[model samples]
Target: MEKLRLYIQIHQLKEQGFKIAAIARKLEISRNTVYKFLGMSFEEATDWVVSLGRRRRKLDRYQDHIVYWLR
Candidate 1:
């Protein structure tokens, strides 16, 4: 979700005539990240973010145990 928001903001700033370096500074992100996001289309960005959510974390195996403990 956060990445999606950042991607949108990057594009908006770009459209508003902001330079890539300026956008990186304003957003406090690395220039490379800004470039990477700008290179992706909206649909591709959306899919990338969605795929991130679907990735398995190292702690994923303990998820059920963690939830059971919390309860």
Candidate 2:
């Protein structure tokens, strides 16, 4: 589902007196995800979604090698 949709659903469910676990089950998402989004305003949710999209590590593909080197 789209981030905005998920955010709206979370808030709506919460307003309707649904618990985090119930929201998770009803939405087929994880409880952690429901918890993460539960208190965010629409603007905050949008920024979070955009930030997720912008998450591009400089060496994501070499993460395992980096870890091995560090060890």
Candidate 3:
């Protein structure tokens, strides 16, 4: 399924009161993604989906700066 359509369907499931983890299991995606969709406004989720598929990231990339700046 395409990302946008899937997003809309997930949004509906959320409105119907399904838990995030259950939706993720049914959809075969990550629990974090489901929870994130649950928390985001539609516009925010749209922008997020558009941005999410665009790149790779590593924890180490941000950790260095955070560790340097944080106590």
Best by TM-score: 1
TM-score of structure candidate 3: 0.56
lDDT of candidate 3 vs native? 0.78
Winner of 2 and 3 under lDDT: 2
Each model's lDDT comes to 0.97, 0.89, 0.78
Per-residue alpha-carbon lDDT of candidate 1 for residues 1-71, written as tens digits (9 for 90 to 100): 89999999999999999999999999999999999999999999999999998999999999999999999
The Cα RMSD of model 1 versus the native structure comes to 1.9
TM-score of each: 0.81, 0.69, 0.56
Model 2 over residues 1-66: C-alpha lDDT tens digits? 398998998899999999889999999999999988876778898888889877988899899999
Where does the lowest 10-residue lDDT sum fall in candidate 1? 50-59
Q: In candidate 3, which residue pairs get closer than 3 Å at backbone N, Cα or C atoms, i.e. clash?
A: none
lDDT per residue for candidate 3 within 1-71, as digits (tens), equals: 27667778788887788888878988899988777666777788778777877767787579878898996
Candidate 3 residue spans exceeding 4 A from truth: 52-71
Candidate 2: which stretches are off by over 4 Å?
A: 57-71
